[model samples]
Target chain A: MDISAFVLFWAAIFTSNILLTNFLGMCSYLSVSREVESSFGLGVAVVFVLTITAALNWLVYHYILVYFGIVYLQFIVFIIVIAAFVQLLELIIERYTPALYYTLGIFLPLITVNCAIFGVSLFLVIRNYNFLQSIAFGAGSGIGWLLAILMLAAIRRKLKEKMVPLGLQGVGISLIITGIMALAFVGFSGIVQIQ
Target chain B: MFTIIIKDVTVLSAIGSLLAIIMVIAQRRLSNYGDCKIDINGKRELVIKGGNSLLSSLSDKQIFLPSACGGRGSCAACKCKVISGGGPILPTEKPLLTKAELAAGDIRLACQVKVKSDIKIEIPAGIFNIRRFNATVTEIIDYTYDTKGITFKFADGEKIDFLAGQYVQLETKPYGKVKQGVIRAYSISSKPEINSSLQLIIRYVPEGICTTWVHQHLKLGDTVSLTGPYGDFFLRDTDADIIYVAGGSGKAPIKSMLEHLAVIGCKRKMTYFFGARTTKDLYLTDEMHAFEKVFPSFEYVPVLSHSEQGDGWTGKTGFVMPYFKDAIRDPKNTEAYLCGSPGMINAVTKALIEEGIPKDKIYYDSFG
Candidate 1:
């Protein structure tokens, strides 16, 4: 909480991205980054889940866990909160907004156990971010993830027309691009370093 | 120390219970669509709890639609016309549907359509006639080393009125560690006229669940459940000359159709090309010969692929493709009905197409 909320926000997006810098959530990152449309769907879902769960976990950790002096139960409790919130959200959206339920709600289940969502909550605690700073970091990290996947998906879509060598196709090329993206993001470390 | 353990346990349980309670209440408030009315083809109305997919909702009423992938929405076989209350098609179903179907604005996959409210849909009229029946195994005759013909008599003297070439979903009890029973489609080998009982020729497919149960576990008088008369590989009303080609257990629907044709005194000239690996793989030779005697215009041509040096085999040899010319008097006037493996069906379709039979005229029920 010592550093400004604006600084932490920019730092999460540029210098210490949850996906590029820490590499917490790679499963959905690699698989869903094949098409821009689906990758967009998954990225938005991840962002939505990550930001909400981060705030929810912070509240639960501070209000419940700290109040009860059972901080050891943070892991299980955080997971349950994230999963239950996503399920409840999906049901509610499917009932009220059928269109959004089909498009965005379809991707919510994939984010239930996503380490990236959990990683943001942990980062908020580890860095001792206050309420506003935690929200900024959560949102910035989500934007950073969204940026990474959209880039990968767009490049992959272009690569579909080009001929890559037989062995280094699909996941092979995606990883190389991700590594290059990570290296490029390293250049932004000189501007602001969060971790 | 005792109080610390109690505190930790109570906190954890409280958090978990609170979240569970919220989710349960949210689910009830949001997802309770209540009873919905499904008006199908304007002929039938079904009242059901309107939360499940249209496929399961209709299936709950014993009206089984043909779905190759069950209800995963993979196979578009469960497509039905939704006149109204069918919402806009989702992205998942858009790729599987054709441009024409999409433009029609009514065709929707039953498995994909959730029963949210009152929906009006039009399905094949035949789907209305499908029924669930309990039947008992009355006979099991060895058709080949790997194939057996089993007769099942419907319990309670119930009769299943199926088309000549239609198939039934034979359900098998859960044996061994398999917790739930499974259903597999098998063509009705008995004549459709004989509605009280029907028979199926099931060939042992190494690890096939239904085949294994039918061949090894099922005994005479063992009761089995089944749903009926699904599939469209039946004989058309055309009087065009017929060409029936079947291999292995593909002979079931053909047998049903032939018996039906004979019973109805069909006057269409018929030529059946039966393909097999060897003499042992061939079955129903006597029955086919008996058909030759009873039906004046019917002809049988059995082809052996793996005939040995001295197997006493004297018939049209090799694949059935080359014998199309010999079997047909006029290819243009002939309609071919093929039942076999995918490979066999592809080859037969190609051969028939090359023999000048139009693609539309060649009806087939390839093995799934």
Candidate 2:
């Protein structure tokens, strides 16, 4: 509760990279990283959903669940909230941002199952962060996921022509690359401890 | 301790009740739009409660438009012409529709479009007969490594009156991470007279939603949801000689039509050119041979396109269409019903038309 918003933000990105650190949303990260443009679109959508849902979930937990003394139901409540939020976000995005919707296309609905969004909310609750800290944590965690996927997408684009070994092709090579990236991000943990 | 536990339980129940009440309130307040009338092509009118998508609203009223993605707007298959009251086209539907289609006043994806008011739309006349049947899977027989013949019997005394060569959407309950039921279309292989049951020949495409479910998770005696007798692929009632061509799992509707012809005892001369790569790829050979016995003028031609001579194969050795060219010297008086992969259908259709079969005489259904 005493954590500064800036530290929470930076820590969420580097020390607690959602994709690399927690492996919270590997499904879409693996599927959508084939193209930079589509990955970027999905990344942006995830950022939007994470930021909003984190804040919304925090409010629902604190104001409703905590006030009513039903904190044990957080898991079920969080999932429902996330699903509904994703649906509403899809409607709004499809209505207002047609180009983004086209770029995201089929990847938009896949966000409902993207664990990073729920993970962010659960992390905020576990950390017992204030509203501003929760928002920063959510937005930063999403940005962290986006950054990791975009980097992977760029590597995939470059490696498209390269003849990967049969054993290391497709998901095999992707996991190896992700492992290296995870190691690289480990250096940032020395500078900041999110916990 | 008991008091604390009771307090906790009571509080949890109270919160749950409150949330349920809120959801109910939201449903009544947010979803209500009074009674809405949907006028289709100035012919049929449906009066129903509003605030749902036109696709689902129409489906609820027993009018089924072909939608592969279950109103997710991903398939873009459910396009209807909204002559009026459709409002502005949303961005989601723009990619699927053409400028000409938009100019012709097509409004939006029926799934994406909410019917808040009385609306007038034009759906194809064929959709009127589409009904959702509650059928139980009575039999499942393996046709090939990837393909299976699934037969669904109607609930006692319930039967669907559908023509041969029409397709029905099979619904599969979500398994694993999939949380909702997904529906996919399969051409009905059963003849119309066999009204008590429906048969579908499903080939499992790896990672394919419905087919994978049907192949792996589906079982006999399980209730399945189906909507149809949809699609424009059916035998044309003409006196001309019929050339029926099909390959792989594309044999469903073709089989249906053949069974139908046998049942009706039609005496018109017909040749069914079934193409396969090997013996394993071919199925229902006995059924086709049985039809040959029943329909004296009908012949069953199973052509192996890539069969090795040493494999003890005596069938025609070439692509089915070229063999068809040699078989049908004069197609001017022939009506061709072609069903198969897109490549096969396109190549065969072109060859048939070039061989003097009138363009109008050739009907095809392409499986992408």
Candidate 3:
């Protein structure tokens, strides 16, 4: 629980991946991974949102929930904070950066209920990570999620025309590929372990 | 225990309310596009407060665009060309547009296109004629076993100016488990000449959202919102003999046309082939018979598709297509206007084409 922020960052990306390892944000991961372009956009948005919300939620948890001994309310409070941040980020991105908004704006609303954001917050709370460590873990898990989705999207792009078994087409095939990838990431477990 | 429960509820609600307040403030401040100019077809201009979808914004300005799903991006019906300033199409709109449509550029679903910036858009010119009308349900009559005719009277002396065959999008409020209101297009059955009231023939389709709501939950004198006088299925002004074919509640618009023709005292030879299962499936038979007496050249033929032997059936038995040859004297110059289910429309259209009627001469509205 007292792991270095740098180690937690690396560990989150490889071993305790919010997506691949924990399987927390599977809905958007499966759905939006059909195209590399959209997957990249959503991945970047996730990386940005996860880092911000993790820090914000950590502050809210320590300063507010823990102060009241109502840490049990972390789930609802964390979801609310994530949703509120995503909403605010979407509005800012859309208004100022029109080009970035075109790519990332559409994905912001989808990311609100993406359990990965909530998952990272919960992971930080459960693991007792301070603000800096929480942010590192959030960013790393986001990048890990990004890497996983991008790889799947590339494979899916190639498999677009390639005939797979009828029963394992579309999402079925993607999930099977994800399982194999998760096994491959298991190879990185020796490099670092935080959970 | 009491204090802890109160504390838990209070904390959760406080956090929720705080976030809600922040979101509201952020939405207003960040999303305020400030008096955005909507250059519609480069012909008309409107300055309105921005931050709503293009469809709703236009509708707010009394310039109704055809959207069946209200502002939801699900229905791909509300499509317009954003010539400039409505940035790249969002992910929600991508699934609905076709590959060729995407390649052609600028064709965006109006419901998905948020008005965050001043944008010029091109819509069908016919869209201008459609208007949002406020009306109240005046009468609900059981026309048959499953079908009911609901007459909606225009509120506040306001009148609906629509063609006989054109239809309106009926808006239903959220009732029971239906969380949001649904928009359904039903043909205007009442005579357009009346203007003050419009009637729609709604058949109960079991679990159908709109029809079930209309049948069970809808009551007399209830207020309703309607967008209308839309569709290209109106009567064409030509000298060609008319062949009217319809079935089930499909008979609604055809009856409107017949009534309009009756009011105008149309002289062209007309024959109506109304198909049904049996006597129980039929409604407004007496009205059609009355039309036969009024018009000098009009003929009424009701074909019972599933008429049983010795069921007190005296009218034409069998499908409508078999009786088409006997109904008409001129096939080449006949303009057939059909309304019904897609199956019925396709079958009747094929039969008409085979009977020597030109393909372009046939008109129908297969409502989704």
Interface RMSD of 2: 5.2
Worst 10 residues of 2 chain B by lDDT: B22-31
- The residue-by-residue lDDT of candidate 3 on B1-368, one tens digit each, is 99999998898888899889999998878877888899999999988888788888898888877777777777787888999978777777888999988997799988877787788999888888888789999999999999999999988888888888998999999999999888898998988899988999999999999999999999998999998777889999999999999888988998899888888988889999898999899999999989988888888888897898778999988889998897677888899999888898999999999999999999998755
Give lDDT tens digits, candidate 2, residues B228-302.
888888987877888999888889999899888877878788889998998778888888988878986878899
Cα lDDT for residue A48, candidate 3? 90
| Residue A58 error, candidate 2, Å | 24
- Clashing residue pairs in candidate 2 are none
What TM-score quantifies how close candidate 2 is to the native fold?
0.62
Candidates, DockQ: 0.72, 0.14, 0.45
- In order of DockQ, best first, we have 1, 3, 2
Listed in order, each prediction's TM-score against the native is: 0.94, 0.62, 0.79
Q: Which candidate has the highest TM-score of all? A: 1
Q: Per-residue lDDT for A53-147 in model 1, tens only? A: 87888888889899889888888898889899989878977886665677666567767877889889888888788888888888888989999
After superposing candidate 2, which stretches have Cα over 4 Å from the reference?
A1-195, B1-34, B98-100
Q: Sort every candidate by lDDT, greatest first.
A: 3, 1, 2
lDDT of 3: 0.88
